[model samples]
Target: MVHFLPDILAFFFIAALIAQRLSVDLRLPDAAYQLITYILLITIGLKGGQAIANNASMALIGHSGLIITMGIVITLVALIIIQIFSKLNKADRVTLAAHYGSVSVGTFAVAVNYLEVSQIPYELTLNLFVALLELPAIILGLYLLSDKTHKLNVKTILAHKSLALIIIGMLIGALYGEISEPLVKNLKPMFGVMLALYLVHMGALAGAKISDIGSNKVFIVSFALIMPLIGASIALFCSWLIGLSHGGATLLAVLGASASYIAVPAVFEQAYPEANIAQALFASLAISFSVNVIWGIELYTQAALLISSL
Candidate 1:
């Protein structure tokens, strides 16, 4: 049930698209919806911090860091492999590269629950690493794009509100850590209620976005679907080298395979406002994230078993 919440959220996303298509008047109150989302974001961060506090250790940090570093490398390697498969320009490649490099916070949250249920132990402080890894790929991808393709100023990219919020969240999470109890407690119920409410609101937003999508973007849609699978394959092979257990390795691969729809697109939209936000969201919603949540876990599990059999 716990491993299912993220999927539920993803469904809410689809519902959003469908609702918009249906022209339903099911709209969330704007102020209330945003307020709920804001609280949920803070709560997720603090909850992650507390999880880390519970499992904090030097060895855990060292191990998780190694896995995380591998995650970054896996994303880059995937980018190279993807370039080999189908030609994408440097800007697109960098955009795609950044997508894979950062862990999907939602996916990471889901995988952690899976581990908890399966009785697998992973370093919870890895949440900090998850937060740490969120932006570098975007930064690196942007620089790669600037040097090789679309030349955008670094300042413009850095100044994005979405990116800024992520940086702030990570910084606050780090500084607060165990010190974050009171605030977290006060925020928890608010987030809990908000998460429930905003899920419905997001459905409406997605519906609106879907209504806006058009037939001219077929090529862009194809790219979004293909990229994450390419990223995940490289991650799976590299996972063994990271010394992750079978379950952990599979989860890590999924993390690497997943794209940051919420985090990346929000930031990228600001920096590359001309770039297709719909493409990113659809790719994540329709292809990558959907694949991961639906049958990807089972698929990875089977592959892990096969590898163990060998």
Candidate 2:
């Protein structure tokens, strides 16, 4: 697991750095980003839909809703901690909160890969949790940051690319039932390639922001490490309370721990234009993502196992 996973992530990361060093003008066009995002959202949605179709149950709905509430609690936890420790203003703190509260698809994919490679069984319906976890924290963070008189425009919220894709994919996947799987089969390989392209671009973007990250390195690094620990603690408790198996506990821990670089940032840049994009990008993409992908998964899994055993 470690051998190929590290190489795949490192290769794109190092490739981006190499591009930066060589002045090779490596950059992804906006079209490519949108296409990749759509593909990923749809893939998860279809998988989730497939899972639900095979085993539609009220209990699953309850579990999804409960896990989503956990997402909100996790968001607020991060926000409160950041407010106390960091000097950033309300907007920046909310921005950071929203990002940290949402799950990272890249990191989620890695965790799923780890479980698969290790032969541990996990809930495939957790993909639905991925869809569920995206919006609440972001909306809650925005509400917290908004003035008392300010009301969120629902239309505007629905129009966001990430939410739209998720909704569309979920609807098609759930409504269409067994038929969607065969149609999507041919498109699977392209998804991996697109993901690699996306990460490559992400690495390049991170490389470009190296100078910006240096100024707040200490604070960002600390938050990245510490926040996941807090999140995992919450997940460990909640998962045990809910009687989740080892794999379910780990995925929940990851959902609590992972941060969004892809979905919310697009909305954030538009919604909170005053917030520091560099800080959000640097913290989520560079710091938190690496921590979760590298060692946090194993750490959270072990912690969850220990907690569950007791």
Candidate 3:
């Protein structure tokens, strides 16, 4: 009963989906959900800042760059893998690449929740950094997948409300940590409730979209199961190389394997509109949704045990 938060979240997500199936009124307004997401994201940034404040040292800084680099490389590799296994055009491939290249906040959130449920701790700054990895690879994916007529548009970047919020999160985190007092002061209680509310709303919304899942969801389903297995192994080995603890390595591996359905897709919709948003969205959502919801924790736990053994 105690070890059930992940499953509980999954349950709500599935329930929300069922509601969607039945055509129920479980729709969380886009603005409302987005607002919740913004609050939580800002909270995450503040948390990151606090982490930096407590453990101010070179050891922590080195890993942040490495983490972003890992995500960037993984994004490119995902594009290659999707192209090899699936039939997608250059434009479609570019869109898919960027989506997969970017990490999913929902997936990462689920993983962090799972970790805390299991009584494991990790650096908080990573919450903000996870979102930050795509600034480079997203642009690169555009260059790779966008047409010649589609020059890099600054409006594409600046126009995103969610993107703006996330970037604000990072800045607020940096500022809160460097100058102001703790970001987790009086705001923690409000943010805490906001996080749970946001998660519930997001869960309901995600489940409603489940019918969006179908027979064609296989390639994504398989990738969701397999990518983490591969990514976690890579992360484990990489973690050992960097001299991190086993737990940190496994979590980072989970991070590496994650696909960004939320942030990346939004970026692609603006930057590369012609790309098959449907396919990319399905694949990214499928892999990431399945992993964090059900399979990812099993993989993480199994991998962690195996790594511990070997």
Reference-based TM-score of each model: 0.69, 0.87, 0.82
Off by over 4 Å in 3: 1-6, 54-61, 178-182, 185-196, 207-217, 305-310
lDDT of 3 by residue, 42-103 (tens): 65556665566666679777876776677667767777787788665777766766665566
Candidate 3 weakest lDDT stretch, 10 residues:
207-216
Model 1 accuracy (lDDT, Cα): 0.59
Candidate 1 clashing pairs, residues 3+ apart or interchain = 16-203, 16-207, 17-207
Sorted by lDDT, highest first, which candidate order results? 2, 3, 1
Candidate 1 vs. true structure, TM-score: 0.69
TM-score: which candidate is best? 2
lDDT per residue for candidate 1 within 1-310, as digits (tens), equals 7754444444554565466667874568867755654554555566556656565678666765675666567567757755776455555555656776766655555555455556666534445555556666776666665544456566755664434554565456556776777886676445434544554655565455544444535644665566656656666665555455666566666666677766667666666666556755665655566566555655665565454334
Candidate lDDT scores, in order, read 0.59, 0.76, 0.62
- Candidate 3 accuracy as TM-score: 0.82
Candidate 2: which stretches are off by over 4 Å? 1-7, 18-25, 148-150, 214-216, 304-310
